[model samples]
Target: MKELAYLNKFFFKYKWQLLPGVLFVIISNFFAVLPAQIIRIAFDLVNENIALYRLFNGFDKQSLILDIFGSSLLLFGGLVIVIALIRGLFLFFMRQTIILTSRHIEFDLKNEIYNQYQKLSLAFYRRNNTGDLMNRVTEDVSRVRMYVGPAIMYTINTSVLFVLIIIAMLSVNVKLALYCLAPLPLLAITIYYVNSIINHKSEKIQRRLSTLSSFVQETFSGIRVVKSYVRENNIRDGFAKESEAYKSESLDLVKVQAFFFPTMLLMVGLSTIITIYIGGLQVMNGKISSGNIAEFIVYVNQLTFPVTSLGWVTSLVQRAAASQKRINQFLKTKPEIINPNPNPLKVNGAISFQNVSFTYPDTGIKALKNVSFEIKEGELLAIIGRTGSGKSTIANLVMRMYDVDEGEIKIDHTNIKYLNLEDYRSQTGFVPQEVFLFSDTIARNIAFGQDQLDMQKVEKAAKDAAVYKNIIAFDKKFETFIGERGITLSGGQKQRVSIARAIIKSPQILIFDDCLSAVDTKTEEEILNSLGNVMKGKTSILIAHRVSTIKNADKIIVLDNGEIVEHGTHHLLMNKKGVYFELYEKQLLEEQQELS
Candidate 1:
């Protein structure tokens, strides 16, 4: 019930449909109760010996023939017609209401989740699996839709039918009504207990279902890897375990439901027997009329349906409650990064770090320790380091992927954190080590976000990256669709395309994190030479492992153990005989040995 409260506004928004639907249900129940009355009336007429004779009275031979055909049994025939019409109308309205409400609610929920996904930070995705998030968006949301549709309306109808039946029963014979309702208090208590058990188990059941959904999604997405590695048997065994667990959990919930529903029916059966036995005695003793006993029995059966229906409705509500909790948890998670009074900064490409330090949230280990550097506009700065020397961390910080624990990063003398994230990020072009390309046309991928891209500019960038010839050789040229993750292209081609994408963006600052590592040295030099003219007056941070890659930079900063150890030009650093010089000499010797 608490979970459902969140949707009160949507319910109110569609209450017009609900109101008519409820009215139709009540009208249908009214007609349904008529059969009981017609039965009582016919029984009384028979007991008085007036049924057949009176129906045929006041008719001559000719009129008698007409009356026999036209004077049909009025009470029973009228009830049949009434019930059919009412049921038709009710079914029509209920179907329409359920369809409209479910679609509207589902649309609203998906939209809200999408909005929340946009607001969340990259850190959230780092810890969460894509398949798990997809499950919540699709499966869990469908469960909530079911609750809002048929479940809510049916519950209301059950409650109304119960009250109507009770009133009709007590009117004819209060004693029999009280006696038949004797087990109701106990039935309510039993339902409460069953509901509590079902709710607890339902939580586990939904969680297991989510896990099963995630397993299927993850396995399918990585099916190629599984096939390549010949791990089908291992994957099958793992999936079987998850599937079996989900099956067991689902069966357990079904077992509880199976047990509780029949027990409720048993209670209904017991009450029916009591109504027949106790009411029959009263009739035989001449304390009550036979027609009244018949009516009382009819109402007793009517009462049973609502009570039994209550159990199933309770189960659905419990399942919905569990789903709502999971969804709410996701909705409540505030993004790790947020702007506190943002001011958009227009960068002139001068970037500086003043005593910046950062630690990961989960590990609490410093990724960067008091790291500081400055690069003026148009400078080609190279960041060189061994793995885990904080080279990548510096790029991440510059992009504000993670906030600094202590100190400030400024662009054009303004703190980067204070700038609007979107604005700041737009001015920086980032190409990571693992180039990710969408499964789209090469032209679309290169001109990613810009609405109207200049194809000439795109061609120039591609030519500069040394990948234009490759693209032109393809069947559709720039229009060729790259298969998933650019699986259709070679590693070097993919890297060059990524470089082309960054170059087309024309950002004030470009950060290339080992983007050219996949290409050969000759191709790399060609691309670098082409970039030299375009990179004029633009700040560029090049992260690379090979000494030859960064040797041409205006300044090289060599890092070791998360701290800067050396900073100078290629010749100056070589003369210093430090870590950079040793690595450069070793790389040069390897090249010489290969040539020999």
Candidate 2:
């Protein structure tokens, strides 16, 4: 019961559909029991009339006998048909309302999980794998629906039939009814033990399945790397290992069911044997009529089905419980990054970091320490750093991907924590170092952030990003479909497309985190030249490894060991002959070697 408490919200939400469905189930079960009663009455009528005919032999009793049997048979046949028709009608409506409602709830739960995924911080995504999350949204949600649908339906059906049949059986003979139900307590004990094992096994099986799914997802996502390294056999072996583990856990669950079903059937079979032997003896001793004995046999047989169905329903309940627990835990996780203020001040692109210190989660070392900087509106600032100098960390902090451990980051003279995260982010456009594009057309990808595509704006942005000529060279122009992650396009084209996407947003501040690393110097210069007009009167931050990419910026900052070691123009940094100058000389020597 505690395991199922998570479903209370869904049950309440769909109560309108579920309440009527439950009523129909009750009505259907009631009609279902009427046939057994009809049979009993018909048998009794035949027995009594036969005795009367035997007593009144050779008289005008032939007509009476014919009338009695004829009326009894007609009433029994008509009632059977009517009851069957009513039961079938109600069963249809019950399934339509309850089972279909579960499906609707399943749909809603999937969307809700996806919505939660969107709201969660980047750290949450880092902690979980894609395939495990996919399994939770798909397989786990499906198991929950089984509980809401067939499990609930059969439980209700079994309860109603059990009560009505027990009452009818008692009315015939209390002693026989007691005897018929003697094995039920044993059956309940068996189910209790079996259910616990099943629940434990089910949890293990679901976890193994998620592991298998994650392995498959990762293998496919990095297939190119695997193939380039000629590790197909290794990957195949890894997959086989995961698949075997999954298979082993599944077989354990199957073993539990194998033990459970036969035990339940044995109990039901024993009860049926007891009822027949005892009721037959009563018939011979004249304690009960033959008709009563026959009806008792029918009632016991009817009870057998629901009792046997209990084993299956219990398994479904256990599986659903295990799945719901996983989903509940995921939903309980709150995002670490959230807007503190409902109404926040507008951003004007003026940014400042005051003695900020930060460390990554699950790591002892600080990524940035006591970093302080300010960029006035409409100024272009360039950040140059060696690998692991915390350049990307700075970009992440500016995007509010993680909060600072000390001091404050301010935008428009207000702490970023007090700003509406969405509104503040909307005012800035970011092109990450590794760009990702959807499997969509050029125009659609360019206008991805907009509610609707404006072709004019899209073309202008593409031209500004210097990718419009390459796009028009294609036969379909903007309508050309790029493959997954823009696989159909070159690296430079993908980078330009990403820039076009950001440009169309018309953000007040633009941040490029080594977005042009893939392109040649000539192409890089072309893009930068095209962006000159766009960057006018807008705050811009360019983070790059190449000095050529940021040499002409208003001011350049060089980072070493997570601290700014040089702050000046490119010419001034070169004259200082420090870390920045060393990096510039190294790059120049590499280019000269390539030409040679």
Candidate 3:
């Protein structure tokens, strides 16, 4: 209930709907309870007329009594039907208002969670799995909705019925009514203890469901890997194991319910039995009429559903408390990176790293150390490094993917952190080593960076990235579906398409980190030639391992084990015969050997 308190704002938000729904519950219940009193009156009337008919022996007098008696019974029967119809109508209204409002709340809650997920930093995503996050937004919210709709409705109905039935019973005969209600206090105490056990079991079941969902998501996403490795049997066996665990947890909860519902029914049956025994004894003693006993029985039976649902509502609220706690915890998380400035600023893209150092937070690996360099606007600076030499770390810092742990990164002579994160990222074009494109058409994928798709810009960007020829060769050309993650295309084609998508924005700062690793040297030269023209007025940072790729740059920096080993023009580095010269000579020899 403490966790469920968070939903009070939503209840208040839709108060008008909830208020009417509650009214409908009360009114319908009032009509339903009235029928029991009618039944009592009809029974008493019949009982009275039985003696009156016995007293009138002659035809005329007895016939008169019979006619009146028959007519009165019919009238009472008609009245009960009308009351039932009226109650049914109100029940319809109850569902219309309350159930519909729950759906609306569901929509708002899902959107709220999705928006929060979008606003969270990448570090937050690193900490949580996609399945757990998805389950919280979807399955957990669904459980909570059961509390908001059916649980709440049943609770209100039960409470109203209890009040009406108890008052009516006491007014008729206090002693019998008290005896009938003797079992309820024990029933309630049982529910209280059962509720704690159910709460604990429900949370365990939900966590198991999250684990199951994660396994399925990961399996589907990596199905190709599984098939290629011939691990289909292994995956199937794993799924079976998870499914069995999920089934076991579900059965454990079900077992508790199996124990719980019967107990409630047994208590209900006991109350009914007590009503019959006590009421019969009172009637034998001439304290109350048989009709009173009939009415008491109706009230007890009417209580049957409400009493059963009391347990159900308690169960629902408990599960909902568990789920809402998870949701509230997620909502409370503040993103590590936030937009520092409300106002958008100009981006000339003069990016500089001053005494910069960074460590990957997840792995705690030092990827950069006190490295300093500056790339002016409209200058092309290339970084060459061995694998794990922090070349990509510089690219990541320039793009603001991760804030540096030490020292300052500035753009246009302002600290990068001070810029609006949205504005800064919007002005930059990044092509990471691994390419990811949506399961969309070629032109649409190229134009995915913006809201509006322009085919002309798409074509131009595709031509510049040198993927236009490959796209045209397809049957539908730009309209061809690239498949998931662009798996329909070859590796080099995917890389080029990713480049096209990046350049389609005409960004101020362009960072390409090993984006050309998939293509041959010949295709690389053509793409680089096109990029030279496209990047004429923009700041470009090219990160690569091939010397041929960066030899023509105005400046090149070589990184070795997270430190700068050389920084100079290509000519100066070659003349110095340092690490840069060694790599250049080695690659050149390999190419020459392959050519021969």
lDDT of 1: 0.83
**What pairs collide in candidate 2?**
none
- For model 1, where is the 10-residue window of minimal lDDT? 64-73
Q: Report the lDDT tens digits of candidate 1 across residue range 264-338.
A: 888888888888888898889887778877887787787777777788788888888888778887888997777
State the lDDT of candidate 3 residue by residue for 94-162, as single tens digits: 999999999998888889999999888766887789889999999999999999999999998999999
Best by lDDT, which number?
Answer: 3
TM-scores of the candidates are 0.91, 0.96, 0.97
lDDT of each: 0.83, 0.89, 0.91
Better of 1 and 3 by lDDT: 3
* Selected candidate, larger TM-score, 2 vs 3: 3
CA RMSD of all predictions: 3.1, 1.7, 1.5
- Runs in model 1 with CA error above 4 Å? 12-28, 46-75, 285-288, 303-305, 341-345, 452-457
**Native-vs-model 3 lDDT?**
0.91
Tell me how far the alpha carbon of residue 418 in candidate 1 is from the true structure, in angstroms, after superposition: 1.7
lDDT of 2 by residue, 361-401 (tens): 74556888889989999999999998888888889899999
Error of 3 at 438 (Å): 1.1
